[model samples]
Structure formats: structure tokens, C-alpha cells
Target: MPIRTTETTVTLDHPFALTSFDSVLPAGVYRLEIDEEEISGLSFSAYRRISARLHTPAIGVLSSIREALPIDTRELEEVLKADRTPIILPAGE
Candidate 1:
């Protein structure tokens, strides 16, 4: 089976907690890794998510070690939607 791994980062402005973590995480940039497997028997190529992992302690932190935690992608998306900073555009045409 062919599996594809995707890596990305998420940023939160305020402290947030995740079900997979024991404590609240500080606001900063966090790395998210997702794995998806290609599905067969289809006319078009498609992939389904297999798993998602979040890197602990945020990026650029002075931690000796980092832990990859298994997380629910939907939950993470909700958290991000609630925690994301809104961008304001200048008044101009």
C-alpha cells in the first residue's frame, strides 16, 4: 500500500489544550504531520487520512526533546478555527 506523509504547521495566539495532551500548550507555532493512504478500485486517484500527529513544545522552543502525539484532525481544526488570529486588511480599493 502506498502511504503519503504530509507536514504542516499551525499557529495559535492563545493557550489551548488538546485531548491528546495532558496540559495546556503555550501559544506558538506547532507542527502537524498527517499520513494518508491511496485508495484503489477508483477511476480517479484518491487518498484517505490514516493518522495525524502533533509536535509538542511548539517550534523554536528550548526543549531537549519533542514528542509526536497522535491527535484527532477534526478536533485540531476546530481548535484552530477558534484560536486563529484574524487578519485585517487596510481600507483601500
Candidate 2:
């Protein structure tokens, strides 16, 4: 999910460049258009914050480790096959 506030029609050939300020968009359904034609629809959600720190002494070590990791295609397939359920987070919990 992404955060989008305003809905503006842009040409598909030249999509509007996104900026940090555009990141302030609220969560909602969005319709993407190109030359007055509806191209796609997207739902944007609030940004999720993450806080983590990794301490390593070797330079470029983390890069190598990340590259060595294997991508599980089955996980992606399962996500795509799963039913579409609205993700609801507890408010101020």
C-alpha cells in the first residue's frame, strides 16, 4: 500500500514524477488515467514505520549476505492466491 492525497490524471507515456511531498497522500482508492483513458486503479495506505539497526564491522559484508539470500517464489504465489481481505490495524492501540 502507498500514500496518495491528490488524484491527478497524467499521461501514461509520461507519468508524473513522484516526490517526497507526494508521499503525504492519504490512504484511499486511486484511479490512474492516461489521455482520458482509465489505465489502472490503486489503493494507497499510510506508510509503515520501521526501526532497526545493524552493526557490522566488515565493509560490503551486508551486501554480500543480502545477495546470497534466496527468494521464495512460492511465498509470492501464495500471497497472490490469498483472498483479498481489508487490512485493519487497531487505532492507537
Candidate 3:
């Protein structure tokens, strides 16, 4: 399927999950890049692929603070997958 990119904002009142992502998104606004596609066959054909990245937290002393924020527990497979970067602070910040 061919994919096109579209920009949208996700606002969560509670933790939310994405098919490809393991993390539960916290309550907040998240900027996302959505991919859309269309297919044709005997019946209906439509599919989409989307990808979004969150910034990693700091190490050592600041680690615990980062943990409180909503995100996946595992490490990112590809560290430098994109040119753009996201910045997330501690829960209170």
C-alpha cells in the first residue's frame, strides 16, 4: 500500500495505546504524523501505516523523574530514526 503523511494532534484523557507502540500515552497533547493508504480488490481495501517518536529521558539521577511520564518500558530499536526530535519533561514540569 502507498502511504501519505498527514499531521494531527492526539489529546488523551487517559492512557492510550497504538497498534505499533507498546507504551500507553499519558493525558496530554501529542503531535503525530499519520500515514494513509487505499487499496482495491474484490471487496473494500484500505490500510494505513503510521509512526511517531518520543524523546528519550536522561540517565542516572534524572531517570526516576522521567519514569513517571507515560511511555513504553522498552528502549527504542532505532535511536536515530528521524531528523525531528521530541522533548518531554518530568511529570511536574
Candidate 4:
């Protein structure tokens, strides 16, 4: 089961790339368009991604790492900021 699915679409000033635990999204902004769950004492989730050819395209699907990971969680809205910091999930989760 999934707790929820989240999507945050934002315009990038330049080409952007976001790398998550199991997925990577290459530079693209959706001008015309855009775009999880749990277990035991721990939570595990799976997600299916959709992409827009005209606007933003999904680079890959992502799954939360279940073992030896810190589970770095950030808002998509935050990552797409002008700072352009890379998203890194710590191990030992």
C-alpha cells in the first residue's frame, strides 16, 4: 500500500537535474504542462512516474530504499529552488 503520491511542478531558470535514491530526472521545465507508502516499524513505498513530452519529462521511477539508508526526504518544491542543490539520501536507513 501507498501512503500518498506527491507532485510539484516548477519552472527552472536553466536545465535542471534531480537525483533521488533510485531515480534521476534530467533538466526540463513544464511550461505547457508538468508533474508513495509503508511497512512494520519501517515504511516502504513504490511509485509510478508519468512524463510530458511537450513540457516536463520524468527521468525515472523511484523507490524508497529499505535498508541502510537515512531516507533523505525533501519537498520537490524546495529542490527546484534557485540554489539548485542536489538531493542526496543518506545510507543506513
Candidate 5:
């Protein structure tokens, strides 16, 4: 039973919320950690994602307590995609 962990930083320009979090997270860099397990009985090495963790309070925010909140990969992807997509302002302001 071999397990692998990958870490990456994700930046969000706008505040967002995740199901795992109690409140909306401020816009900033967040640490994302993904854990996977190697699939057995395969000629080629393959890994399946087991869990994902998102660091709270962003990377630069000052807080007494920091927590790694569990998150779903799919939901995280959706939030990232939404963050990347520009908001369309129709008509006159």
C-alpha cells in the first residue's frame, strides 16, 4: 500500500466558499495538498486520488490558528475555474 502526496499553491482573486469551510475564504494564495494511492495489478504505475486538503486563511493572512480543511477535488476545480473566468458586466453601470 503505497501512498503519494502532492502539494501546490492556488491563487484566487475573489473570495470564495467551500463546503468544508464554515465561512467564505478571502481571496489569496491557498495551499492545496492531494493524497493518492498506487493502484495494484497494473503494469504501469497509476495513482488514484484519495483525499484533498485546502489550507485555510490563505497563505499571507495572519491568524492565530491555521487549519487544513478537507475539500473535494471536483469542487475545488470548479471554484478555480470560476475564479479564472472574468465576470461579465452587461449594460451600463
Candidate 6:
């Protein structure tokens, strides 16, 4: 018999911290939950792969911010929630 599958995909205009999904998921192996999850035994492999690619750029921006200005996490969070895409840059240039 063939296995039945269901898939969900959410593409954000801006990248979100992995924590964003915490509210929706319980700690378990979830497959077929995301379109990327369909890629074999590693259910979240695709998401991880994509995140790795984005990490470098994101980190560069974060580092730049730390160098240039005093950052407030609460204020940043409020701004981020309002904007679909917020710029994150490393402290220097």
C-alpha cells in the first residue's frame, strides 16, 4: 500500500528566527508537515539547509549592528513585528 502524505509550506518575505515556529510545533519528528520535509528521511533537512545559507548574511548584519549602535531587543522586536522586512546589518560597514 502507498503511504498517504500531507504537506504545508510557508514562505516568508523575510527570514524568521527558528523560534518563530515554536508555538506551532511540539517536540517531535514531524514529516510531511512542510513541503521541504518531503526530502527523504531527514524531515527538516531542507529547512536546515536553507537556514544555513541564510545564516551567514544574517550574522554579518547582526554583527555590524553590534559594532555601530546600541541595540535594544524589545524595541527591535516591536519594529520587526510591524515590518515585513527589517534590515539587520553588522556593527561596522
1-93 per-residue lDDT for model 5 (tens digits): 799999999999999998998889899999999999999999999999999999887887899999998999999999999999998898895
Candidate 3 is scored at a TM of 0.33
Q: Give me the overall lDDT of model 2.
A: 0.27
| CA lDDT scores, all candidates in order | 0.93, 0.27, 0.43, 0.40, 0.93, 0.31
Report how far off residue 2 is in candidate 1 (Å).
0.7
Residue 6 lDDT in model 2? Answer: 31
- Cα displacement (Å) at residue 4, model 1: 0.4
For 1-93, candidate 2 gives per-residue lDDT tens digits of 332233232112111212312222222222321122222353732333221111121222233331111213343234324424456889986
Model 1 C-alpha lDDT per residue in residues 2-90, reported as the tens digit of each score: 99999999998998998999999999999999999999889999999999999988999999879999999999999999887576788
Q: Find the number of clashing residue pairs for candidate 1.
A: 0
Q: How many residue pairs clash in each candidate?
A: 0, 2, 0, 6, 0, 9
Write one digit per residue (lDDT tens) for candidate 6, span 11-92: 3344334332322222221111211122456655332211111112222133332221222334435534745556789889
- Model 5 pairs in collision: none
Clashing pairs in 6: 61-89, 61-90, 63-90, 63-91, 64-90, 64-91, 65-90, 65-91, 67-91
lDDT, candidate 3, at 81: 28
Please give me the total number of clashing residue pairs in predicted model 6: 9
RMSD of each: 5.1, 19.3, 13.4, 14.5, 0.8, 16.0
Write down the TM-score of every candidate: 0.87, 0.17, 0.33, 0.26, 0.95, 0.20
- Between the candidate structures 1 and 6, which one is better when assessed by TM-score? 1
Clashing pairs in 2: 4-25, 5-25
- Which candidate leads in TM-score? 5
The positional error of residue 80 in candidate 1, measured at the CA in angstroms, is 0.4
Candidate 6 lDDT for residue 70: 23
Tens-place lDDT digits, model 4, residues 8-51: 44455455434433444445443322224433354654443332
